[model samples]
Every structure is written in structure tokens, then in C-alpha cells.
Target: MKKPHLIVPEGMEFIRDDIGYAPAVLAGNTLYISGQIGRDDQRQLVVDKEAQFVMVFENMKRVLEAAGGSFENLVEMTSFHTDMRDLPLFMQVRDRYLQGVYVAWTAIGAASLCGAPGYFLEVKGIAQLN
Candidate 1:
């Protein structure tokens, strides 16, 4: 069996050293991405709903790129939302990144996420790497 490779983007070492988890793990042709919350490059939580939504997707994009793929490679995605009402705006920002490459998706309503209340969304995905 091939050994799994941990995929951590540049400047994301905190996710491993502080959080104790790989941002994503690549096994053979499959890439398993961890749930990324709405945080800026400085790790500060974003306050705006739409910006937060975009930030989380950017985080996922970074993980995918580190694994030598893009959003187009995503085969499955799961998202958690603190407020279900944000679905419409979330879908709009999501579509901007996905660009119509359809993937299996599940949106879950969560009471809270990332051990906090301010985070509005968290997204995790699986990609098939070429």
C-alpha cells in the first residue's frame, strides 16, 4: 500500500503544530481535506458573512492547490453553517469559486463550529488528484 502524504500549504504549519492535524492528506489519488473555518491569513475570524464564506473557500482552494489540484478536482464537499439562512449568499460565493463544476455536496446546519460561535461556516472537501 502507498503511504499517505500530508498536504500542508505554505504558512499553514500552525494547523499541524498547534491544531495537531494535517490540513489535508493525500493517499494515492485521493485528497482528504480538513474542515476550514472562516479566518483571514492572519488567523483572525472574519466578521462579514459573505467575506467569511469566501475566505473559507479560499482556504479550501489553498489546500487543494497544495495537493496539486484545484476546485475542479473536488468530487465531494461538505459544509457546516451556523445559520442556515445564509445558504443563498453562500451558494453565490461558492459558485464563483467552483465555476459550475458540479460536485457532490452536503450542507449541514450546526449549532457551533471550530469551538467558537463567531465562525459562520466551515467547509471540507475531497478531491481526486490527477
Candidate 2:
């Protein structure tokens, strides 16, 4: 069997150096992605909730694409949110990204995140090779 490739995107060093985790992991046919924050491709956090949701999903997509996978292949997801009020807005945002794809999802409340003013939410997921 061919070993699954380990992929780190060209500009991902910012994630490792400052974000504090590997962006994605490919072990055999499964991909385990680290939690993605509301940061741009440049790694700057966007404070707007709806906009941040889009930004965070974009980050997640980049990692998934690097692993040769996509959202439709995802089986599970967990979201951590500092404010519960944002949950409904998050659902609206999530629907935009997850159209036609159903993922087993968990949403949790958190007191804080690693960054100041904190993120509206953080998202993580697992994907199977298709």
C-alpha cells in the first residue's frame, strides 16, 4: 500500500509557528484536520461573525484541498463558540458551506480561545478519503 502523503501548504508555516498546530494530517485514507479559526489566508483573525465564518471555512477548505479532499467527504465536525447568540448566525453560515453535505456536528460553548477578543467560533472536522 502506498503511504498516505503528508501535505502542508506553501504558506502554512504561519499556522505552525503562530496558530499552534498542524493544519491537516493524512493518515492512510483518513484526514484529521486541526481546528480552524476565523483567520484569513494571511492568518489575521477577522472579528466579524458572519465574515469570520466565511474566512474560517476558507481556511478549512484550503487544508482539505491540500489533503486532496473536500467538504462532501467530511464525516464529522465540532464547533467551539464563545457566544451562544452567534449559533444561529453560524448555522446560516454553515448552511452556505455545507449545502447538500450532512456532517455529524457538535457545537460547544467555550469561555475563550487563544486570541484576544477571541474568535466568534472555531471549527474542526474529520474527512474520509473518497
Candidate 3:
């Protein structure tokens, strides 16, 4: 059995202290990333919808990198959005970060997220590490 390894990327300390959850956890070849929101390093949520969408991916990228993975390594992704109307904006931002890698993804509409008021979306993913 492989032991679970917590991924604590630099500049992501706020997630640990404020949320009490690891940004990501590596078990064997798989990395399970926690739901990432649009909050900055200071734990402040971004106000703009488009900007917030981008920030979610950016936060996930940091965790993936820390786990020795990249966007191309992602095998599945699930996103939670406060409004389904923002799907277009979220897709645009996702394309920018994911490039052409086509991974299994699902987007769900949610009423809100924990600790992030005014945030429009959150994303979590599973990645295969090399």
C-alpha cells in the first residue's frame, strides 16, 4: 500500500491554515487535488467573474505542479459554479490553461462555496503523476 503524501506548494499556505485541508494529496501515481477557488494567497476572493475563473485554474496548477504533475496530466476534473451562466467564461479560461488536452470534466452548479463569498466557481481534479 502506498502512503498518502500531502502537497503543500509554496505560496499556498493560506489553504492549509484557513481551510485545514491539503491543496493536493498524492497516493501512488494519482494526485487528488482539493477544490480550488479564486482566493489569492491572502485568502481574499477575486471579485471579477472572469478573473475568478482564471484564478481557480491557476490555483489548481500550483497544486498539480507541487505533486509533480501538469495540466496535461489531469485525467478528470469537476467544477462547481454558483451560476451556470458563467460556464462560457469558465470554459474560456480553462482552455487557456489546459491548451488542447482533453480530459474528462464535469461542471456542477452550486449555491455557494465554503469560506469564499462572492466567488463564482471552484474546481477540483485528479492527475496522474509521472
Candidate 4:
């Protein structure tokens, strides 16, 4: 087994320095991305539900790129939502980002995420690097 390499994208140092967590970890060719919330580049929670979904996917994309990968490299993804009713809207936003590249995905419902009230959705993924 190869040692895992931590991935921290620029401007995301707070994830490790302040949150004490690696945003993503690359073990050999597999990149395990941590759950990404609906926060903008400024780390502020996005208020619009649909836009918030976009931010979550965008954050995940940043992590994937940091690991030398892209959406095409994603093998599996898991999403947690505070409200199941948001699934329709979430899927709409997700499909826009994913385009026609379909990967194994699982959507779960949770009471809360990020240990905060503003966050309604969180997504994490696993990607295979070239």
C-alpha cells in the first residue's frame, strides 16, 4: 500500500489548519474527498438552495483538481441532505455539473451537517487518478 497524500487546495488551508481535517487524501491512484458543504469560495454559506447545491459540487471539483483529477475521474459519490424534499432540485444542479458522465452515486438524508444550521447539503466523492 502506498502512503496517503493530503490535498489542500489554495485558499482552503483553513480546512486543515483550523478544522483539523484534510480536504482530500490520495492513496495511490484513489482520491478520497471529504464532504464538501454549500459554501462559496469566500467560505460563506450560500443562501439560495439551488445555488448552494452548485457550490457544493464546485467545492468537490476543486478538491478533485487538487488531486490531479476531474469529474471524469470520479468513480463514486455520496451526498447527504438535511431535507429529502430537496432531492429534485439537487439532482438538477448536479446533472449540470456532471453532464453526461454518470458515476455510482448515493444520496442520503441527514438531520444536519457541518454541525451548523445553514448547511443543507454535503457531498463527498472518490476518484481514480491516471
The lDDT of each candidate is 0.91, 0.83, 0.88, 0.89
**Residue-by-residue lDDT tens digits, candidate 1, 1-130:** 8999899898677765666688899999999999988887788999988889998999999999988999999999999999999999999999999997999999999999988778999999999999
Off by over 4 Å in 1: 17-19
How well does candidate 2 score on lDDT at residue 41? Answer: 61
Distance (Å) between predicted and true CA of 50, model 4?
0.9
Please state the error at residue 112 of candidate 2 in Å: 0.7
Listed in order, each prediction's TM-score against the native is 0.95, 0.88, 0.93, 0.93
User: Compared with the true structure, what per-residue lDDT tens digits does model 2 show for residues 51-98?
Assistant: 998888887888888888888888999999999888889999888888
Give, for candidate 3, the lowest lDDT window spanning 10 residues: 11-20
TM-score of 3: 0.93
List candidate 4 stretches off by more than 4 Å.
17-19
- Give stretches of model 3 more than 4 Å off: 15-20
State the local distance difference test value for candidate 4: 0.89
Who wins the lDDT comparison?
Answer: 1
Q: Supply the TM-score for candidate 1.
A: 0.95
Residues 13-128, candidate 4, lDDT per residue (tens digit)?
Answer: 77656666888989999999999988876889999888889988988989988888889999899999999999999999988888888999999999989888979899998899
